[model samples]
Target: MLTSESRRRDFPTLDGRAYLNTAAEGVPPLAVGEALAQYFRDKQLGMDGRVPHAAQWEAARALTAEFLGLTAAEIGICSCSSEAYNLAALALQLQPGDEVICTDLDFPASSTPWLQPACPATLRLWKHRSGALHVEDLIPLLSPRTRLVNVSLVSFYNGFTVALPPIVEAVRKHSPALLGVDVTQAIGRIPLDLRGADLIVSSTHKWILASHGGGLVGVPKDRAKEWTAPAGGWFNLEDAFGPGSFEAVKSKPGAASFMVGMPNYPALYAVRAGLEYLRGVGVANIDAHARPLVLHCLTELRKLPVEVLTPDEPDHIAGILAFKHPKAAEINARLHAGNVHVMNPTGRLRVAVHGYNTHDDIERLLRELKAALAAV
Candidate 1:
């Protein structure tokens, strides 16, 4: 049974703050905090002299795979979304004259790797129509030489959700181009079936309620054996490290091949703890609870002088709502003064309401926003 939790008891950070800056970073619940403390204690005690926490690391990978409705073989644990994207970029081995399609509205983290000088591929940028990603526009851009089509599942700048399945099907039907997705903003906040993307990369910091240096990458079964990470490390080796001639270090099969080095066990523990909590509550329940608050915020913001960046339709909304206000800086400062936290990125105030956020938080934010607008 999925119940709505319109309270702040689960998240301690919301004790005195509205904590609407989830797109910036998430506040872990009490369980993740305790897990981190235990990790530190184990490290200080020098238990097993290191490498003893390998099983826990495997569990984290399994949890991530389960969250995405994938097999354990598909998940690769990386430090951040950028690292995962880079791994995907290397696996494709983009040759000269090959083309890669991406959007101008997406975060640079998704596009920059393709643009990097290391790959000689031609980068094609498609402008988002009115800050909204239109799947139809890509029909003209894709060609037989298109090696990859990269896109963000959600716009970090404007909170606009991209309908990915249509685009993914379109590209796959025409060309052999791989669909790479940056889900840093979408994964934990939205319901993702993972049907379209061949390579999915996401950082768990924002919506997963985990700390930094923890991210995940997904590769399909067909691409698993074909993909090999550019960089090699011991963890990727199929052979064990102890009492062995280190001359032959073979990369592990599946997405684990991208792990350039030892996995971050400490951070992986925190990731597991947070992921466990989300599962307990159920993602559909979380979306059902948080989305209403976003709609409420969008409804009120529409009544103001600000220009709404997110789409007006219900299906288009996730956990974020961004609005362009001329007094964005002033309004942000005043909102901060009033203990309401939000992000002012790209001249628009980006408000992210998570599953744990309460209705009171939305009400307080609106009241403060109105006052700040008047004062400005």
Candidate 2:
């Protein structure tokens, strides 16, 4: 039940503009900015006398865990989504004969790591079914040799929220391949539980609305023990001194082992602020507030000549609504001129809604979009 008025003043950009670009780069509120400033100031206080506080890092990670319905042990702080993906790719230890299936609709960060030479895994890029991701399409691609399946929980191009529960059930029943999700597009915007998946990764920038360079990877504590990938920073090990020799080191337990170096203090503080704000506002309430706005936009957008790429079904709808037109990029450019900020992701126009947005923002976007489309 957190309204725009309660949080609008926290975001400077929301003064008189429609910022429907949370998918690309979330606008950090004044709290996050102040936290960032305060972090550097405190860091300078110690000068050469202090180390990064591990306890603060854990608190921030716990905030993320609660937001995602995961445990702290399952969360491994990462510098970015690419880093998280890299850790997952290494942990899988795929070989020449091993096969990994990924959907073409996912962002490159989710698919490229498994395709690296180190893994040497056969890559299968499953095509979308009827312009959307479907379990039926992915099921046919899985086989016994499939060691992993990479997918985006939500599509960045079309704003399609991939229904994960059914897909996970089918994959586990049919193939030995483990499921991995890139949650960059859907984490804070939707409800996510990591109970059934093998692993999941996310950057704090998008839906969590935090520092851009911060990320985390989630894996069960037992799975973390069996991981083969060696993230080589000294701090990643539990015993860096190694009793007498550095060779005797072992990685810290669970996802924390994935932290290769010192965590960025500034980003960590920003994450704490962002996560605290979300906790106060409530993720469920945010989802309820945003979904109606997106559905309203989708319903009204269909009246225009543009082709809506995102599915209208309840299973597929998310905070994002993407539309395609011959002059999509031009229309978005004009919308920007009119102070309506939407994304031109490739050729599609994507409007992203978040907790801080108001119904009036979407109304202005529609009015501006109508004018922009006509002008284009």
Q: Model 1: per-residue lDDT, tens digit, 1-376?
A: 1233324456655777787999999888888888788777667767562654666677788888887778877888978887877777777777889999989868877888877777899899877877787777888888999988888878888787878779878898878888887788887777788786778788878998888988788887777765667556777767747556366556676588778787787788888888888888888888988888899899998998789888787776788889888889999999999999999986889999888788888998999999998898
Clashing pairs in 1: none
TM-scores for every predicted model: 0.93, 0.94
The whole-model C-alpha lDDT of candidate 2 against the native structure comes to 0.80
Error of 1 at 115 (Å): 1.8
Worst 10 residues of 2 by lDDT: 47-56
**What count of clashes does model 2 give?**
0
Cα lDDT of model 2 by residue, 1-376, tens digit: 2465666677766788888999998888788898888777677878541344455587888987786667887777778888877877766767788898988888888888776666788899878865688788788888999988878888887888877788888788889888888888888888776566777788888877788778777776656654434667766777776664455656676577678787877788888888887777777889988888988999999898899988777668778888899999889889999889999977899989998888988999999988987787
Model 2 TM-score is 0.94
Q: What are the clashing pairs of model 2?
A: none
CA deviation > 4 Å runs, candidate 2: 47-52, 226-228, 243-248
